[model samples]
Target: MAMGVHGRRGRGGRRAPMAEINVTPLVDVMLVLLIIFMVTAPLLATGVPVDLPQSRAAPLDQQAKPTQVSLDAQGRIFIDDAPVAEAALPQRLADLAAAPAPPEGRRVYLRADRSLDYGRVMRVMGELNRAGLNHVALVSTGEDQP
Candidate 1:
């Protein structure tokens, strides 16, 4: 060991040890990553466009994976990718509602094309409602959040 300023041995003649951990740079990097995620999270949720019919009712809070019924532009009805005849809708929904469920009740989501007739949509809703399926939902491309 070499002599230091005060004639005392000085850490094998090396420099003094680091007394504090440098965490400010790490915190800055983490904050930058957090800001990046906060900015991009909302943009990642883009969806298809549709002019949704509006009402004053609050959206339903559901806990189950709701059944999705889609009506195409040509007034064709689909229940989870299988084309469903209009005549068979009542029995189909009844069967689904009556089947064993996991949770959040026997709720259904109905997606009608924007070009479809309101009465047609209403009829589907009515049929499901009348079949004792009280938790039917009209699924649409919600309003653009600008």
Candidate 2:
């Protein structure tokens, strides 16, 4: 007779060290997430919220650095970082057009403070439209309750 304890198999199969990091799947998932964010990032913003006046206007198609027109709550107007008198808009647009480069396509972005009057917004838009800068986009903050 021999002692049975010495040669018995252990309680379970022997464990083996993991041989792979499996980074390919992780990298694929990360790359896909990065692409999704890059595609959607431009559609987001955060600031004082406003209910934008609605219109039947068609969406604009564009690919250029647009000229910006900003209106403060006090009804002051700024065009491309310079305060513009209400009367000088057309000439200013012309000046922008005369400047060098591919951005002079007469495109403009209109950003109005949420507290501003509708008539004021329309008036500024009208001025730029009359200046032959037919391409104008209203800038707005993303929907966020404050």
Candidates in order have lDDT scores of 0.80, 0.77
lDDT of 2 by residue, 1-146 (tens): 78565433445854555567989999999999999999777766554463674444565577776788999989988987899987787788777756764644556789999888889999888877766677787877655545
Model 1 global lDDT (CA atoms, 0 to 1):
0.80
Q: lDDT tens digits, residues 1-146, model 1?
A: 89657533467876666679999999999999999999988887666453476444566776667788888999999988899999999999889878997655666788888788989989988888888888767764545465
Could you say which candidate leads in TM-score? 1
In candidate 2, stretches whose alpha carbon ends up further than 4 angstroms from where it belongs are 1-50, 53-63, 98-104
Query: Which number leads on lDDT?
Result: 1
In terms of lDDT, model 2 sits at 0.77
